[model samples]
Target: MRVLVCDDEQLARDRLKRLVEKADNVEVVAEAANGREAIEQTQEHRPDVVLMDIRMPEMDGMEAAEHLSKIDNPPAIIFCTAYDEHALQAFKVHAVDYLLKPVSLSDLEMALSKARTLNRVQLAELGKEVSEEKPRRRGHISARTHRGLELVPVDEVRYFLADQKYVTVCFSEGEVLIDETLKDLETEFGEQFVRIHRNALVALRYIEGMELATAGHHQVRLRGIEERLTVSRRHVAGLRKVLQSL
Candidate 1:
């Protein structure tokens, strides 16, 4: 099996590479220093499995796994971290296994044996777990594009517009389509965003003001974008209360 080694520290990567090489029929395909590189290398190399570290600069493994899960025929994820606390979160993202630091060759080999692509049902179940766990909000949001996985800083997001089955994340530069539900997005980012309508959530910090858009209808003006989103009458009072505290 082809494997990608991802860890911030050189020593950790080296050790993982050595152990991976020891496994029967397994070869070290590439190495990545952080979660961002991990995703890039995975896209370029098409590794069968990734030995992922949970904590790293730029992006954490959990967030990286979320992005990887979107790719076509995503590589199996096996989290290798020093901390034990993230084990649940690791499995929540559908990792093949969780291996702690100072990993043993036997454990690594056993984990490698379990590598397999996740099915749509498993991915759907993971989404449900993510929403239910209310995992710590990530700093950036990831979307798969033709070029590969793109990371959009959560702070740059102007708003989230939900259609039937997809949510469009509008950030400072542009917009990207994502599979997350609006309700799940609101639940995870409630502090930073507010629901303006059943179909939309606007960034609290980006709200320029509110005004009447048409007869008996209201719209919200956001700072970075020209388009004005309609504010549902039912949510207007709640939006006002949230805005007042901000």
Candidate 2:
């Protein structure tokens, strides 16, 4: 069984790596310092199980596990934390097991055995439960590409353009296709992004200004990119007000 260990503390990760190495037939695939790295490592390694820490900076373990659950053949999660308060929340996300801090080798092995038995259907069910709850406003958005899963930091994203069923995420570096609806994106990132058109959402921080494109039509100019997006008639007034405030 392949395993990834994630913890904020380097010592904790080292200890877990040692314990994981001792487990029969289990290899320590990778180690992550926080939840974002955990997700990236999981994407790269495709581990069968993840030993996660709950309280982490940037992104927490629960949020990372929720994101991972949406992927194909998701690895089973086993949360390891010092606080017992997070146990209920851990089980709510359908963790394979929850081990308290200073985890024992025997307990970890049992959890790994349980993780190995989790079928796709079980992981699917967990994903559904996570989706039913209020969608988390993430610091980063994930996209599945031929290379693998790509993570785009929300702060760096300039805009989201919806073309039929797919949403194109324009970031500082480049753009990537994501499997998210514009309406859902609007709902999740309403504070940071504004609906400029029916098919587009522009980041408030990236908005340079609005210009008249043609007779009675206007387009928004973004800071990082030259491509100007058409702003709908209904949203023109609101967008102008947003720009004024900025």
Candidate 3:
């Protein structure tokens, strides 16, 4: 199985790589010096497993893992960290296993064994869900619009605009305002959505591409949809990353 090792320290990374090599079925395919690199490598390599460090420059492993978990066919993650305090959060994000630093070969092997088993189960479950949901295409977004609750279906939807208090579900049929913020929708419908701004969430399949506009701004072009959605500067990097993965 292909594996990616991520650690800020060169010694730790090399140690993990050697340990992975000792395993019968596992191979260390790539290494990262930080969480940001880990995320980039994850997109580029698509490894079956990631040995992630908990803390690093640019981004923390927990945050990167959280984002990585949203990707389609995400690798089974095995967090390799020195801190034991983060074990609970690691498991909360559905990590396959956690190995403390100065990792033992036996422990690494055990984690690898568990990761292989868990990855199989995860892939199977993902396939089943995708087949079962048949995820609605260009369907209505349930939200509060005008003065009351409203449902804005695909044909009518112009775009989804996010504000601090709510997400305005704009459609040709008329806009429906939802009380829930973009973050709420992100957690609820992450599979069908892409984040363009910290406050904004756009349907993934609807996004055609991104346009570089004047004044260092970027706009998202939606497929079968004319309205352009604004991409926040902070989220532009993440948007670009996700697009590249697709």
Which residue pairs collide in model 3, if any?
140-153, 144-177, 145-176, 145-177, 156-172
* Residue-by-residue lDDT tens digits, candidate 3, 54-118: 88876667756654554567778899999999998776666788989889999998988887877
Number of colliding residue pairs in each model: 0, 0, 5
**Candidate 2 residue spans exceeding 4 A from truth:** 128-135
Task: Name the regions of candidate 3 deviating beyond 4 angstroms.
Answer: 120-160, 163-246
Give the range of the ten consecutive residues with the poorest summed lDDT in model 3. 130-139
User: Deviation in angstroms for 178 in model 3?
Assistant: 16
Q: Write down the lDDT of every candidate, Cα atoms only.
A: 0.86, 0.89, 0.73
For candidate 1, lDDT tens digit of each residue in 205-235?
Answer: 9998888777888999999789999999999
Could you tell me which residue pairs clash in candidate 2?
Answer: none
lDDT of 2 by residue, 125-225 (tens): 87767755634677888787776767788999999999988999999889899877898889999999999999999999888899998787999899979
* Ranking of models by TM-score: 2, 1, 3
- Candidate 2 steric clashes: 0
Measured against the true structure, the TM-scores of the candidates, in listed sequence, are 0.87, 0.89, 0.54
Where does the lowest 10-residue lDDT sum fall in candidate 1? 123-132
Q: Rank the candidates by lDDT, best first.
A: 2, 1, 3
